[model samples]
Target: MNAKMRNDAYSIFSEAIAAVDPAACIYRSVSKKDNELIISGEKYDLSRYDNIYAIAFGKAAISMSKAIEDVLGDSLSSGLAVTKYGFGNCLSKMQVFESNHPVPDDSSVKAGQMVHDFLEKTQASDLVIFLISGGGSALLTYPRKGITISDIARITDSLMRAGATIDELNTARKHLCSIKGGGLAKMAFPSESVSLILSDVVGDPLDVIASGPTVPDTSSFGDFNEIIERYEIGVTMGIGGLLEDGLEGVIEETPKAGDYIFEKTSHYLVGNNSLALQEAEIRASKLGYNTMVMSSSIVGEAREVAKVLAAITREERHGVSPLPLPACILAGGETTVTMKGNGSGGRCQEAALSFGIETSGLHNVLLLAAGTDGNDGTTDYAGAFADGETLERGKSIQLDAHAYLSDNNSYAYFKETGDLVKTGPTGTNVMDIYIILVDMF
Candidate 1:
């Protein structure tokens, strides 16, 4: 396997993900008009719906809400946009609630209450414009009847560090929450609902995007209980009460396929990781590199995937595989990283550091791994990049890539080496985007 081509490919791929910033994309997608909103090929005339209101939540909520405000500023009767802390900006007509991520905090609980309050006052003639995207799950969190915010936060963080899949984690979340799993949809019932989703989940399952607050639940309490037991997670009495209610048919079930709540509801998947990958492919091809989009929903442990991809690139470069030199390989998906240390990096950073150490300055090889959400793990940097020179750069500063990887501190390593990719809150999330560009034959 030729090591250099593999390294260069990965580096170029990272650049490609960084190229199409989501905030810029959202800004471009929206424009203002007097009585209409044109979003992702759907044209909604404000006059058609008797009453129009906005409800948006996610990592990209601030930017997405901004776009919504521009289009439906005067027409919107009331609206709420919730986002993580430190990402708020001014907006007209809509309340911007800055909250927390990866786990729901008190602000998240308040945001959930706000949603409930708003929906409680809604009428059948009202139109609810649900602007949902990745991170909405964490942003729209509300504990069930008896659960506490701290309990939710602890469970969420533990599940994340335990390397649970997003679906598994969300399944648990849906059961524990009052507004997730179709609970919001239940509240918005009998109203005209329109959900515009920027999917971060692989395959863009409607039920999995933001835990499908406005969608039906195919997984029931039994399924949720199974996952909890499998993970050995503690469930509070509040969650237990909800489960009992569900079992006894005391509370109404979430909207099913033929539910009346969906009578006037429609869902649009505006964007996804695959779209981002396709855009990257076209751009790389235009840049004179042959591109292959591996998978938009790539999932696995970050380091293992990085090493496997490295090996594949090496094989391709040595003329043992089909693709020739100067090729670009792309992958988009959320990778998991089990916390083995007090590392300060996310999956993308860990992947980058692992790739950097394994490649060890092999000429012509570079890699970039980053989350599409703009924040990777606990760091502000979206992700990190590494090439043939990355290891050498680490050595010059007496930095041990291996040690950093052990501690899961790729953010520190990449920051010291000046390879961290920074894009503040890309108002969209499809998943992580990875690009592997091979420039050296």
Candidate 2:
């Protein structure tokens, strides 16, 4: 391993994560002056009607909520937030509930009910400041009364293991839940609501981030059925009845675009993966490395993406370049993992393992992949790293990288090679980041 180059790679990644800090991003985009709440470019006067409240969810919930608390101060009446377990702290004005991620749990159901009940207490003259980020779909879940947490968890696990895209997973959740797909907006209807969102979805698609709880939704029950059929998942997995009811129009659909409920709501995308990538690029350039923002919306299977990245790195190494020598290539966006084995790993670990094996003998190059949230999938690590020596290190133990990759056991492989990134929870999530360092300097 070129220790200096490897060190630089991680430093650049850290710089990217810092740029997407939810609280800092909120501080930059939101403020209060003379009873006016200025969020992004829109201004809402707090002196207009009555109560002002805030609600937050996702991995960055606490930080975002705190930022809003700082902005609203005495004007804020009360608030609530839901976040992944151990990623939150007690707040003065905001009630924090911890829940599961990548899957919903009982705590998630309670959080949903709590938020709903709180909104029920508001009147037409009230205002809600929604601080939304990623993971809200799971952290803030309230399925129709029939679908239990087990039902949602089973179906979510099925879809995820089947390699369903985030849009597809959220599509299914939106139809089944009463609190997703603009359901929260409906709850806050007649009361003006401002959502300051940090984008975790690529291209910042409003409806897909946290299932677009506070934005107008264009997805429908029909869309949900299409995904279920396409993936052939959760059919008799216990939630089939919910889908049947949805398709038969027996259940009310989630709010759609131009719905009256959205009239009182405004949404602003404060930050996203692009913001993180830009900061990483700046840091890389300052470190004297040519940098390229490869693609901010790259998505596909983890190993497949790794191959493409490795191919690019090989080209750059041999002078058939995309940017130049000593260059860092950065790409942002989340990837999917199809779990066919019993192995433990997240998308970042899977990508790193695959990339490591692919570029095993290529010197002075480092391939790093991690979640901006500092946690990936079900793993404790934020991500994984790979250098030229990654393969040799595995070979020393008679472990074949391809074998581990095949078993979807990237976590074990990286852990044994001591390449796993253990940054713990970063208190924020903007999706996954990919960094490749091709240094000849």
Candidate 3:
């Protein structure tokens, strides 16, 4: 392994993650002065409202809620924060509940109901502040009548395994849940509300982040049907019945543009993939590398993306690309894995394994791909590292890289090679980061 290059890669990635820390993002976006609260240049006179409540959900819920409490201090009239299991922290003025992610469970149902009940206490004179981040759709969910949590989980798993995009997955989720697709905004109607969001989706579409619980949804039941057809997702009888009811107009649609429910509601994008990439670029430059941010909206199959990245690395090495030797390239965005084998690994790990195969025997080239949230796919490792010797290292241990890649078992392969990147649960989510470093001999 090129230890210096590997260290540089980790350093640049950490700087990127720090740039989008949920607490820092919240602090930068919100503040209070006397009896007035200001957020992103909008001022709300606290004296005009009978109460001020803060509600947060997603992986960043706890850290975000803590930041809100610091800004509002004693004026915060209590709050509720729901996060993925093992990501919760104790807060002074808020109650925290840990739930499941990627799939909603019984705890998710309870959190959803709790949020609904909490919002019921809001009145026309109250103000609601919603902190939304990635994974909120699964962490805070209240299934519509006739649909059980099990049904939601089954569908979510199916869509994911089928390699559905975040937009498609969230569109389906918005229809099946009671509180997504602007339902939360409707619940707090008559009470002025503001949502501070940390976007984990490509292009930062407010309507798709956390299934747009507070923002107006551009998609409809028809869109959901199109997604199902595109992915060939098998729908259970109960879910199918609900979809039919939604299509027939027996069930109301989610709030859309120009809806009255959004009259006093505001949504702000506080943190995103671009912000993280910019910081990474700066850090890489400081490390004496010719750095460039490739793109912040990269998406598609993980293995295919890895192939392209490896090709770029070779181009840069040969002076065919813009950056010369000792160059660092960065990209950010989530990728999907079409599960073909019963293996444990996330998109980043899968990408790493594929990149390793494509760049075998190359000198002084390294790749690091990891999720900013510190959890990649279903594994504890955030991602993994790949280099010219990655395959050789595995071969010496009787490990076949091609076999592991074919089985979609990158996690196990990287584990034996000791290249898995583990950072535990980072208190923020901006999506995934990919770093490629090419060094001179």
Candidate 4:
């Protein structure tokens, strides 16, 4: 690939991925006409409900709420949106609450209580529009009856550090939270509710998004206890008492199927990582590169996946006979990194470093990895990118990509080399997008 071709390919792929960003594609999936909102081809009339309210939690909640305002206009009675600090914005009728993410804090605890209170206030004829998306798991934190906010926070931090997948992490959260695992829906029982979901989980499973505040949960408190024990997370005495009491059947289980709460609620998947991946593939094909979306459910440690993708790119570029050339391989999904060093970075940046070092000085190859949510880990940069020249740039600075990887400082390394891809916040959450373009020699 020549310089121009590579740059063109990068631009095409970047825009394609951004096209499905929460800020761009969410409105396409939902629209409002008067008192009615259409979501995913289904029409819902908000006028029928006497008390119309909204509860949005996630990185995309602010933008999603804004979109709702565009449709609902003055009819929005009351609502709440809890997001990370810098991501918060004003909405006419909805109160914006900003809190810590990846780790719960006092602010998250207070906001969660408000969520529970809001749910309790819903009447039978009320319309509860639940805006669900990624990052909500932490944003919507409300500990179970006996558990304290500190207990929940400690467990969450441990699970995250243990490299637990979202599924496993959420399973533990479901058991510890008062509003997760369908508990929020249970609170709004008999009140008509609709969940507008921006899926970040691979395959977009209903039960995993934001820990499924409105979806039915199959896991039990026992399962949650096991996870806590497995991770050896310390909990408060109150939490231990509550768990023991619950295990003894004192507390009623969370709402289940056949419950009135679930009957009155409807869940809709609005957008996901797969959509972003598909869009990227189409754009790559139009740019004259043969493209295939490898998978949207890509998982495992971030570094491992990057190494695997690097090997594949190397094979295809060298044309070991049957492998295709001049192709771009795309993937979307969330990946985790186990933090050991004091360094800072997210999964996408880690993947970039891993790929950068492995494919160093190999011409006709470029790799881009970014989180569609526009924030990777705790950094402002979404992710990073690398071409054949990445290693040379690092070498000039006397920085070893491998050492940075060991310290989980991918973002710092990439930023120094001017390879960090910053998108701020895209307003939509669909996890991460990985792009690899192989050029014919």
Which model scores highest in TM-score?
A: 3
The true-versus-predicted C-alpha distance at residue 120 of model 3, in Å, is 0.9
Model 3, residue pairs in steric clash: none
Q: How would you order the candidates by TM-score, starting with the best? A: 3, 2, 4, 1
Model 2: how far residue 235 lies from native, Å = 2.9
Q: What is the C-alpha lDDT of each candidate?
A: 0.78, 0.88, 0.94, 0.82
Better of 1 and 2 by TM-score: 2
Candidate whose lDDT is highest: 3
Model 2, range 158-202, lDDT digits (tens) per residue? 999999999999998887788888999998888888888988997
Q: List ranges where model 4 is wrong by over 4 Å.
A: 1-6, 23-26, 32-36, 321-324
TM-score per candidate, chains pooled: 0.89, 0.98, 0.99, 0.93
Candidate 3 residue 223 C-alpha distance from true site, Å: 1.3
Greater lDDT among 1 and 3 belongs to: 3
List model 3 lDDT by residue over 1-441, tens digit each. 999999999999999999999999998889999998888998888999888999999999998999999999999999899999999889998999999988999999999999999988899999899999999999999998999999999999999999999999999999999899999999999899999999999999999999999988999999999899888888889889988998999988999989999998998889999999999999999999998899999899999999999999889877799777689999999899999988889999999999999999899999999999999998988999999899999999999999999899999999999999999999999999999999997
Q: After superposition, how far is residue 7 of candidate 1 from its true place, in Å?
A: 14
Q: Which candidate model has the greater lDDT, 2 or 4? A: 2
Output the better candidate (2/3) by TM-score. Answer: 3
Worst 10 residues of 3 by lDDT: 316-325
Q: Please give the range of 10 consecutive residues that has the lowest summed lDDT in model 2.
A: 233-242
Backbone clashes for every candidate come to 15, 0, 0, 1
Residue pairs clashing in model 2 are none
Query: What global local distance difference test value does model 1 have?
Result: 0.78
